[model samples]
Target: MKVLLKGTSLLLLILAGTVMGCKSPENASNFPKRPNILFAIADDQSFPHAGAYGFAEIKTPAFDKVAKDGVLFNNAFVAAPQCSPSRAAILTGKNIWQLEEAGTHASSFPKKLNVFTDMLEDAGYQLGYTGKAWGPGNWKIAGWDRNPVGPAYNEKELTTVPSTGINKRDYFGNFSHFLEKRATGKPFFFWYGGHEPHRVYEPGSGAKAGKRFKNVQLPGFLPDDSVTRNDVIDYAFEIEYFDAHLLKMLKLLEEKGELANTVVVVTADNGMPFPYAKANLQEYGTHVPLAISWPDQIKSSKKVDDLVSMIDLAPTFLEIAGIKSAPVMTGQSIVPVLFSKGGENTSKRNYVLTGRERHTHARPDNLGYPARAIRTKEYLYVKNYKPERWPVGDPVPPNDENNKRAQTEGFKTLFPGYHDIDGSPSKTFMMKHQHEESVNRLFKNAFEKRPEAQLFDIQNDPECLYDLSGNTEYSDICADLRNKLDQELTKQGDPRMFGSDIFDSYPRYSPMRNFQGFNARGQYNPAYAD
Candidate 1:
């Protein structure tokens, strides 16, 4: 190798071939050989929402540039649709069912589940994150000395956000701080988890931020009223705000001459926080946008159509960093596809499994709506374990008088108890227009109790409006997909399949509200109603 440095010590080390080959303390690959990593995750955004995906309402130049420079995955998914478990799967490379308490939303995380961030830190990589690393759950209870995602870097704050809904944290400023504090010559890893486009947006903020309601696209399940359209625009505005911070961070990397070598991955934890999305395990819920850039190795401006999961992220990082992935990780690395013929359907993956347990403490007895699913290129099969229970929880608690539980605990449940979908103008409009026949699909698709199994031809009906589970024409296809989903769940040892109570046993760490449940015959079930 040519001696690129002028110092005598550098010349001596290069002349001594043995010294040139000597490994770092972490038994790491050469520091320059391993690229600096920046993983940015947006909270509560979904697929087909970014500008790179051709949505004009949302401006995401930073995410689009990453796609322009490297690979954009069209079929990427998360292990679970909710936040904590989805993020856990991304960091640990395992499904939520495989993780104990970490699997449940707002539940205590068990100490046994190790994460990739700690692995990178142990490998002598400076690791840190800003804004929403991991959850409504308490990680401290799991015996973690710090947040499992990384050490926090959210000390820096902004005077105000663009709107009332936008987060005030200085995401790029904190990332810059992380870079400034990093060890010299050491490859660094930073997680920029942006809390944007989630909920509680300033009313009409999207219109205020130059978003056009006419440009908004409404899913088949959502009513296309003016209120809903305006809400969608507001969501777009927050997404753009998140993208703006990402652009600044990317510019910093380019200014520092680290853009080409640094690996950049941009994605979201789950679907948009709207009715029939986010908490539900439909196509709109699990199918999220993913874009990656590793300019040093992969060619520019290509797209991949293979089925992939966020769980694949940890393994991919380990693979690219020249480190062996732990055996416990179930996800496969995308490195092979990145180095191969970059064409649609050229990737080896055929199917990606996704599922969920509890999301919020929204039901009576703190019960959860459990579901599992498998998505193939042609179809999506969903298996709901509890069909008897309300999927999104009861729309309203029982009307009661002089009942302390109803008075004190009915705050979140009194108006609309389907606590899974976020409360917003879209949701409120849908609920208000439930009586209208044309707009009632939103209510039926989102709030109604469902069958034990559902089959949707994702090729033709990505909206999942037509359920083919009972149709004779699709029986064989449904059977094959159901079998595959069960087989994977069995292999992963999911408690929902085996009827384990460990999921319900994990105590919720977030705020609780007691709810009254009705009997099968419509009478209040006093056992829980009190």
Candidate 2:
């Protein structure tokens, strides 16, 4: 009798592991003993961008090879659209809402929540990380000795980079150093977090590198112009740069005779850093690419269409290690789907839940654009708690008073207006051409206010160009989805259901600026203090 644990205690999880009938992964013999786990995460990349997904603009040979050798997931999503919360969810195997401070961007991680890394370490797996890990937030305040992912291995540095914005962390070199330092004969779990395709990309780098303007595909929400095309192409260039390092790392593993035994999971933290994509609860925001290769266990040439979440990764890792997941985890392991010899959609999940709290210091008083969503194969339903607020951010620039205060307080980055939307060439173009008739709608779609309830038929409108929530024809579908979302959120104890402002109460550890008394002029008001 397989028992599905939900909202159970840690004691129960431990007891179940030792119990005769309830032994963890009752069929543990199916998996090879102690396979190495190689988790490679790109910073801000969306779905269908990699070569495996048939997007020619971005070339990711390593990701494509992993997909060809193992499973290519068509419907993989992050727990939150923002990086911090999304990474927190991936580490904890729980929804962002379940984590208090960690649910918001640049907030301190609570010490009570245990990460899978510690569990894996306890299980005698050698652990380490290179490049970016579970942060942009401070882990020290929570008394963590190191990053939640594990000890760092970022001493290696690259002498030169293709672009000005790309990090010179020497990711592959650092991974080689990590392998050299690890204990002999022990299975390793490594995190290769690549900070690429995020923002501040080199201008015309893609076109200069022989990428054509005609090949670039713009999303429906963005303007179809030279600026947008150039910006997207530049983003693709960075992704390829990240992939090059991944290819080198894979080769290193293969040379060491560990590629076949290593469970290589390649994915992104969130979507592309474009307006209506990164921080928003839209399709491109939460949806990301995923490819996992484990030649010793998983079957090759399989494309899985089942819905999977970043939160599910932790439990999946634990299950593969023959250890039970922590009871606090709300996410179910995808081991069944990973090891399945069946058709594409073998998993039982009908939908995936995604939400966001604070992303950047975009709104006044560090308040986040609170929203939750339920995504199914055909439709996506979103419930925005604060519909009156700007979805992207305040259109107005920061007041001189706030700017001066930030400088006086010694903050690194200035309060750039609309901070939630990453500062990029595309964003600059939209702001400059907001008055043009063709660009006006696109700007509004990205920068303006949104409705409380939004429903999109993803099958037909994958770009989410139309909302069916107000359409009388889809009233029943909308109602049913809303009820389902509400029920699940309530079960998961989402505080927003009862009109609680708990997410806002969490202390933001990052830089902050105040925008007071501007909402009357169609901007932010200083109602809540940061």
Candidate 3:
């Protein structure tokens, strides 16, 4: 049986040695004893960028070394493309929809939920985190005592950084700080959340670091120009910078003689912070780099191509640590896949589902762009709840005085829509060159209005430039995927399936934007007051 609770009582499980208030996983441990967990997650990074993933631009020696020592995952994905929701999934072992307020960007974390960190702590594993945890949101309002990710070791700070907007927190020093505070001779679970490679890079930082532009390769969606290549190089510089700290942490673990017993996982929260990348649920937005190294338990120098979700990491960690997961957790553990000696036997993990809502309050009335997706090995199907709404966000929001006006009556167009896209050098180039034929394609792809239903063959079109949903040749395939998605959502009791409309009604907790209402398609509607 599983432990299920609701309301304020859910947070009362501060008692030790309990597994979601259910039976302990120690009863089911047939393998060796539990291992220490050191999860290192990067902020705003995408797949095919790590050196281990064969991306030529980035140099991730630390990530590559981890892959060499353990298993490298080629197809790793997070539940949402945004930071708050993606990290919420990692903590709860559930999808975005299951998390209520936490499913949206910068919203309140629901205190009723049971996260893996809490479970591990109750099971007697010492836990703490440094750098960014589950964020861009207010965790205190939810009634919990601390951030859902864990306690903070952010007392220490550093000044030297390679670029602007990169986190200056000494992550390696914090990890060492966490080690000093733990109880003697006990298993530990430490989260090293690196705030790197998100956005706001120093101009020409890559060139400043002596990185050659020839090694940069732009994705198919972006233009093959010098600016885009240089932009990507700057991103690479951040990746390498982030990796450098992990290298030092690995050395520290080795020095402590805990390297063999530590389950080291290195990944990211979401995709790159760029237009048509981070906020959108596209291939690049959701696909992330993953490398897990545990020299004691799993095989070395291997690769696993199984479709795995970031949420699944919670259950995997819980299971390995001899703690049972909460019943609300939908993510399946990858322990079996890890111990299977690097074989393609993951028949149950055929689908990788993800979705997003309201990543930023860029639209009038704090409206969210709701979307759900189901990705199989062959194709990817998407269902947009509101096709009439701008996919990125409204071009401009209402003014401070008029922000509280009716949301859907009407408005005037200001700038081109797609404010959900992050501010970046590559985006600046596309916006500046929209008049040219070669660059307009790039702008349209990022700012265009998509249909209610979208389908893409991920194998052939990982960029998702062409929509195969309406094509007659793929009608049956589209219908099958739709049916599959609806059935799964229905089984999971998703509010969307029940016509609940809860997602839209949920209060937008992020600070509202006041940019003046735009181009007559939408109107003013303030989300919520502070």
In candidate 1, list every pair of residues with a backbone clash: none
Clashes of each: 0, 0, 10
* Candidate 3 ranges with C-alpha deviation above 4 Å: 1-27, 324-326, 397-417, 515-530
Reference-based lDDT, residue 219, model 1: 75
Judged by lDDT against the true structure, how good is candidate 3? 0.79
Q: lDDT of model 1 at residue 345?
A: 60
RMSD of each: 11.2, 5.8, 6.0
Stretch of 10 with least lDDT, candidate 2? 517-526
User: Each prediction's Cα lDDT score?
Assistant: 0.79, 0.82, 0.79
- Per-residue accuracy of model 2 over 1-530 as CA lDDT, tens digit each: 11112333323333322111222433343465889999999999988789998898888999999998898899999999988899999998888877767887888787777788998999999998998899888888788989999999999999998878799999999999999998899999999999998777889888887888778777888899888898889899999998999999899999999999999999999999998889988898999999999987775568888998998898889888877634446777888788777465666799999999877766665667999999999999999999988787766555666666766765434445777899988888888899999989878878888899999999999888788899999999999999999988777767676456667666666666555422121122233311
Which of candidates 1 and 3 is the stronger one according to TM-score?
1
Q: In model 3, state the lDDT of residue 55.
A: 85
With candidate 2 superimposed using the best TM-score fit, by how many Å does residue 338's alpha carbon deviate from the native? 1.5
lDDT of 2: 0.82
26, model 3: CA deviation in Å?
13
Residues 204-306, model 1: lDDT tens digits: 9989877789878877778777888888898888999999999999999999999888999999999998988898899989999999998887666678888
How many backbone clashes are present in model 2? Answer: 0
TM-score of 1: 0.90
